[model samples]
Target: MNDADPLPDLDPLVPSTARVYDALLGGRDHFKPDREAADVFLSMVPHAREAALVNRDAFLRGVQYMVREAGIDQILDIGCGLLTKQRTHEVAQEIDPEVRVVYVDKDPMALTHGRALIDTGQTTTVVTGDLRDPSGILAHPQVRAGLDFERPIGLIVWMLMQVAEAEDPDGIVATLMAPLASGSHLFIVTWPDTGDPAQRALSQACLETLGNGWARPVDRVLKHFQGMPMVEPGLEFVPRWYPGDPGREVPSAEDLKPFERTQIAGIAVKP
Candidate 1:
């Protein structure tokens, strides 16, 4: 029932990855720098906006499956960006109204906006935390209280590993899941290593310009799920995981032409 903690400072000049993502999703909380950065990405791949939506769809579908099929009720959404119409809590709660969700993000803006737009009751809450500090995040008051680590929980990491290298992503994943009892699940949705040359160039451009973002092959992504047992339909193009589901429709070959290799997603459960 407590309010979300105060967020850190906001740096407008620096192009925020979160804001750029928000802009890509047609969200209204971005600044000039975010738009400029997003435009740079669009210049390389005009379908970047479509790609973003595809990723969102994949994320929502993954959460829905976890809640409805996996029988999970607690979720930890790491690196959750600005508010969106179909957020993690929204999707999970739709399946199970009592589902408890804890939204975590390093961005101060995300924390502030999440409280205002996402958190509506005791079942959901927002906290300011960094991906680099997985231990801290797991130990946060909100996370500790909102979730029962002794039971199963869903951990959502959408496009976050691309930003982490020092922590040995596999190690980070292990560290984060160590506290949770067996049966917990982790969902990872991120840029795929395979894509059009133009798409690769655009990804590099964003890295050079905004100093964030990276893409890895599916094999590399699987490494992060090392100890966890793969959920059915192991790593594949995000849309391919659970195709034809309401929010997770797999586009026709023609509709997927422009973004066929844009993103990859998978879910794995702790043994």
Candidate 2:
């Protein structure tokens, strides 16, 4: 069997991808190298920080909605970044006590820290697995321990796909969602290609360089939900999905211009 590549070290001097995201979200686990690289990212996509924060907000909202509103008891959070104080399980179980959450990340450090952040007496768990191999994560002990696949599970793939290459993203998502029955739903958020040439080019290049460089157009993104039924708001900007009263809404895609840069969000159910 071909084992996956080992996770990176705690070399704060290297400025890892997750640490860069941590810096963007105002987290403290990063160092000078991460800060420097993040600064470069900001310069390339000016609103990169804002987009990260907005994306976090969307993640919290999605978990809350699924747990409280959708009655989803099982949740699998893929590519979950550094498990800081603000955790998905912390947010979701607050609404429904029986909620089960499994945090999956290819980073070994993330696995250690995420397990640490798991509150005692809670159903939350963590595992080291890559998104490219969805079933491996599903078969992980932590995933099996916390979740029941026979029931509907809410799959949260937040702000993670932009880091995946184009040739296989849709196929990857399909594989992940394939396990769930008809009621299972998937939530995905990503940086989209805006009509603004300058913003689009800058955002594309930055993601391409830092991430996997495969940000897709909205059309390609919609293709991810090819056989699913969309929720009320459908797939759109991350900030626009069922925002609270007087929420932020971009009337048109153009109106959804990047504040320097912006990310997109979508939710669809398996038919």
Candidate 3:
């Protein structure tokens, strides 16, 4: 077995962000540390976990749009937590089972789960690496094995960039998206500091304690995907991004203000 294998000596005492998210999403793979961390974020805003679920749902819709509308079959999902139940590859492959997916995350527990669920790189791979480091991420054996940059690829950086605030977020994304073909697509969801007084207050409180990284403004957050063609109604709250369920109402521009909704999402085409 490879030394980085996820099964052995998994650290339960130290918090795993992916495991923490798993717990938050009502999954059973988390430890006490994960639970405690989740509580801290949740306490700040009762709707914290709800926001995550909403964002995940939007991600599914966006992936479907990429496959059905844009006809993109290759996906590179950065920060794919735990590769849980309903995920990027699963949704994308439902449309085209051969859709190649490369999941990138630095969590050992997430890597372990990926190994158990996704067997090889023939069409899908779970890679262990930090999203902040494009070199290691882009050059990962699994990413190279599954995706061809010479062809169009869909990039999904969902609910993850908050950890990379110290690094140049814009530059990182630019570097990552630079090599894709013309029809390639980039999808991003950022936890912007919500504009609503209560939401912003709550998120601010969480950021103070989490200290994982600082939050960003919505405009600055959208700026991460410059030089890409952001289609109509670009960069709105996650719920506003291509909703699969027609019954869902897009949050009003007012309700989506900072912290009111945790994710600012958009799908942009590489022109």
Cα-based TM-score, every candidate: 0.91, 0.86, 0.88
- Show where candidate 2 strays beyond 4 Å: 1-13, 119-122, 163-167, 198-202, 205-211, 243-257
lDDT of 3 by residue, 184-205 (tens): 9889877666455545644564
Candidates ranked, most accurate by lDDT first: 1, 3, 2
* Candidate 1 Cα outliers beyond 4 Å, as residue runs: 1-4, 243-258
Candidate 2: clashing residue pairs, number? 1
Q: Show pairs that collide, candidate 1.
A: none
C-alpha positional error of residue 207 in candidate 3 after TM-score superposition, expressed in Å: 3.4
Best by TM-score: 1
Model 3 — TM-score against the truth? 0.88
| lDDT by candidate, in order shown | 0.79, 0.71, 0.74
Q: Which has the better TM-score: candidate 1, or candidate 3?
A: 1
Per-residue lDDT tens digits for candidate 2, residues 1-271, read 1133244446655656677788888888777877887887777777778877877887787787778777888788898878886788889878887788877786655765665667342487676787877778777765776778888999987544555554477787888888887788798877666565544654554554454444567787788775688876776677567622235554665555465235667778787
Indicate which candidate wins on lDDT.
1
* Full-model lDDT, candidate 1: 0.79
1 against 2, candidate with superior lDDT: 1
lDDT for 7 (candidate 3): 38
